[model samples]
Target: MHSLSAKDLTLGYGETVIIDGLDIEIPKGEITVLIGGNGCGKSTLLRSLARLLKPKSGNVLLNGEEIAKMKTKEIAKKLAILPQSPVTPEGLTVYELVKQGRHPHRSIMKQWTKEDEDAVQQALESTNILHLQDRAVDSLSGGQRQRAWIALTLAQQTDIILLDEPTTYLDMTHQIEILDLLFDLNEQKGHTVVMVLHDLNLASRYAHHMVAVKDKKIYAQGTPEDIITCELVHDVFQMKCNISCDPIFGTPVCVPHGKGRSVGANQKKRAAI
Candidate 1:
């Protein structure tokens, strides 16, 4: 059974609908990437799945139960969300931030225990931020700060994680690092990861399942090889492109046709010969 799904979901703000009557099921224990152009509702859809956004017309189901009816702490125990460019509280250390993830597991009757400490430690270790645990979150570099935030999510110890553009504003190297970390969490820990990503090529490489959003609906969705094509790119992104294979991963790669330096056709033919 799908751990997360949306049924006839309609989401918007002040009558400006972003997503209308959409339905989607996130495959359990796999990496699902939502891709689309700006304002295409990718983030909106993800937020609704995490119950961060209230839908106008339908329900989000978590573990076959309606999510809207679940208690906040219960939902927190099952799913974790890392929103886009989250703000770090001033003077908060990495360890302190990560420890906050354990809040859902704690209460007036249940104080901190060994389990919470171990979970936080494991999260820092998995994200390779153990060495920076004592450092202030705001003092770390871009990559390190991102890792710290991710460690907070990891410490939640949920089976499912949702992130909105987790790699935004980072350099290409950091972007790959963040994606690779999420990939490891999925492969090694069997966590269900759903995120909105802007880079088509990186998303194709890491995503076990890809959902292309366009025109307030899913344009296509499947493995990259099955659904990512020149036609889909044009229809969804309004761009012309050639579909090629990644030499390393053999996943579909989009090569856009646009103004840039070009080898002449005769030179291309001669080089081919």
Candidate 2:
């Protein structure tokens, strides 16, 4: 029962309490995607779980113990977190950046070990950035830079990984590639992945557990099949949408009601031209 959970989390900045008394039990060895409208406290919650943000009240627990009470290195060994935007040091190569993830495992007296080298190499390979290892991170394309950052997180080799919007600036193909890579990590290594995703369609396809946050609390949570519906979308996102199943993965797809491409009887008649 390896559980990383937030119990009674009153998360916020200073006195501006955003999340008031929330509890979420992260399913171990599964992909959990947190979805919410902007400023709904989803990313804040993830940071709280990683001990990066202190809760206004209550506790974030790792395996039944309070994460806030644990040593930083101990917490790092169990969980690795990638923020929405990370600042890369100037002139630092990808390998140099990835190697930093191994610092938690190194003692004051111990230098870089064979294990560290192997971990960095493996992480680079896993993220498909092995060829770019020697290149400076700042010089890479947006997608490449993102993959480099992901490789750094993977290199840490933690059982639990938290990511905040991993596909922010990437194109569609790279977004899918990133998600697919994460899916493989969850499946092959059984790493507990909890991330904040903006796209409902991708979240539905990839997440084993979907937690929809709203108004500083969870609006709904369950399998994508159960949680993603017309009512939930309207309630959480405030958008009228048609709920349909994805043809490829049979996952829930939300076709939001708005002025976009025409897809009615007129669309069919126009296509017949």
Candidate 3:
């Protein structure tokens, strides 16, 4: 069964609808990436799945139960969401921030226990931020800070994790690092990961299942090989592109046609000669 799904979900702000009557099911224990152009409702859809946004119509389901009816803490125990560019509280250490993830698991009558401590430690270790746990979150570099934030979600010990543009503002190296970390979490820990990503090539590289959002609905969704094509990219992103294969991963790669210098055919012939 899908651990997370949206049934006829309609989301918007005021009267401007962003997503209208959308249905999606996130495959359990896989990486699902939502891709689309700006203002195409990718983030809006993700937020609704996490119950961060209230839908105007339809329902979000978690393990076959309606998510809107579930208690906040109960939902927190099963799902963790890292929003886009989250603000770090001033002077908060990484350890302290990560520890906050345990709040859903804690109670007024319950004291901090070994289980909680272990969860926090494991989260830091999983994100490879154990060494920076004592450092202030604001002091870390972009990559380190992103990892620390991921550790916070990890500390929640949920089976499902959702993130909105987790790699935003990070350099290429850091983006790869963050995606690789999430890939490992899915492969090794069997966690269901869903995120909105802007990079088409990277999304194809890491996503086992990909959903392309366009025109307030899903344009297409499936494995990259099955759904990612020149037509889909042009239709969803409004760009012309060639679909190629990644040499290393064999995933579909989008080579967009845009203005750039071109090597003349004569130059290539002369160079070869």
Name the best candidate (by lDDT). Answer: 3
Q: State model 1's lDDT.
A: 0.94
TM-score of 1: 0.95
After aligning candidate 2 to the native by TM-score, how far in Å is the CA of 98 from where it should be? 0.2
**Candidate 1: residue 142 Cα off by (Å):** 0.9
In candidate 2, what are the lDDT values of residues 139-170, reduced to their tens digit?
A: 99988999899898888889999999999988
Evaluated against the true structure, the overall lDDT of model 2 is 0.92
Ranking, lDDT, top scorer first? 3, 1, 2
On a 0 to 100 scale, what is the lDDT of residue 145 in model 3? 98
User: Per-residue lDDT tens digits of candidate 3, residues 123-223?
Assistant: 99999999999999999999999999999999999999999999999999999999999999999999999999999999999999999999999999999
- Give the range where candidate 3 is weakest over 10 consecutive residues by summed lDDT: 260-269
What are the per-residue Cα lDDT tens digits for candidate 1 across 91-160?
9999999999999999989988999999999999999999999999999999999999999999989999
Greater-TM-score candidate between 2 and 3: 3
Error of 3 at 128 (Å): 0.6
User: For each candidate, how many residue pairs have backbone atoms clashing (under 3 Å)?
Assistant: 0, 0, 0
TM-score of each: 0.95, 0.95, 0.96
Worst 10 residues of 1 by lDDT: 258-267
